[model samples]
Target: MNQGKTKKIVYKTVLHIVLIILSVTMLVPFLWMISSSLKTTQEMFASPPTWIPRYVAWENYTYMLQAAPWMRYFGNTFFISALTIAGQLITCSMAAYAFARLRFKGRNLIFLIYLGTMMIPFQVVMIPQFKIVKILGLVNTHWSLIVPGIFNAFGTFLLRQFFQTIPKELEEAAKIDGCGYPRIFWEIVIKNSKPAIITLVVFTFMNTWNDFQRPLIFLNDDSLWTLSMGLAKFQGTYVTQWNQMMAGALITMVPVLVLYIFAQKYFVQGIVMSGLKE
Candidate 1:
């Protein structure tokens, strides 16, 4: 027993050391971004890359805000992300329920088709997707982002897997109490899938908020540009403005970081629950 305890302690010490190293590796870039954001333009490229600036140049953030229509970018990003999340939650949940609980013909075949779409690289579909958006007059509109994300095969598959693991008895009990399909789905299935939903919300928010390619292709007007697109322009125009770029980067990351801090518990729970088999 004593030997086993000693071995466990040794293992834990090694694990902690490894984790600390990995954490530092991941944190260094973020630290540099923040540190450089507070440094003068000259200090940003100073030899050895100063980890700390001699003076905290807070005006970099102000300069960035004034340099571009950052407030417009923020509004556009928030609008697009919110719409994407709302649409995905409603559509994916309904589709997942249909796959998980309802009996229908060609269910597995349809699901397989959906899964197959995931295998196809986004590049292959980019041109066709753009053409469709153009034809539909959704180009340069928020709908370009909101509509395409509404039907996510991955989100449907994920929620379906979770929904399938729920006990049939709970659903049957609801049915016996005169609950209809919609009522049972909302109360029994959805309530129990809170963690999974929160996971989807976080994922959808992050992806839509940071997405650049689609927006770049669709939104031509600067006024309609999201934060990601704006940042790309910021970097391209002011390549030497490292401080301003870092400030923009830091500002863009704030919402995601705040969200993760609050929803981290559900994120972990969702990951664990997703792995369970019925």
Candidate 2:
């Protein structure tokens, strides 16, 4: 109706076109991987390549399953991810509530010190953690993965920031009603913090599920290996099976893809805190 509105419409149309182009660009590799996995090895390396397979070699998936103990890898990964999620939910939430709501001596300094650990890469701490796990006789056990991953400073920090936004009045009201810290924490804080908790759950689960280095290093047994680790079987020092590798990769990506698809909304909504009012 107006020149300004016309300009806004034109801008949005241009932006949409740009986003569509970017989305297709991003999807090309994924589409190619799907294509390669369906085609035979020769078809994959054919001159000029082909987008569609002459024959959809569904056997590649069957071959992957028979070639490796993928089911065992999936089970092991799920167990590790589940346990890590539970442990992180308990440990991180409690630590976050303490830092955000509870009053104690040296609390701020202690929290700052802990939060600073986020800057330290796992590479720096891996040696000490490995030795600790070894000393505790957890080197080859699932605990080596679960226990070390439970106490993440980033998870604590994320929940702490979310916890701080909650109105102090609600906590005070609960306290005035003779509710104790644990009761208030469970009934009030946690009840109101779903978005943040879900966000943390998604992140922690994804990280623990997709982790390769920890499983590769801490686990010497093939049965305990995760899917990410199992994918290495498709690759060898001397030769690599490109088709099967693509097939294994697509299989490995399924859980992560499923997780994000379902949790995408809560993951985005949790961080914004739009529900909180002044």
The C-alpha TM-scores of every prediction are 0.91, 0.92
Residue by residue across 1-278, what tens digits does model 1's lDDT show?
A: 99999999999999999999999999999998999899988888789878879988999999988999999999999999999999999999999999998998998898788867878988898899999998999998989888997878778878898898889999999988999999999999999998688888887787899898889888899999999999998788776577888899999889989988998886666566546522
lDDT of 1: 0.88
Give the residue spans of candidate 1 off by over 4 A: 1-11, 268-278
User: Which lDDT tens digits does candidate 2 get at residues 1-278?
Assistant: 69999999999999999999999999999999999999997798788999999989888889888988899999999999999999999999999999999999999999989978877988999999999999999999899999998998878888888999999999999999999999999999999999899988988888898898888889988888899888874475316677877888999999988987889886565455423322
Error of 2 at 64 (Å): 0.5
Error at 236, model 1, angstroms: 1.4
Clashing pairs in 2: none
lDDT of each model, Cα atoms only? 0.88, 0.88
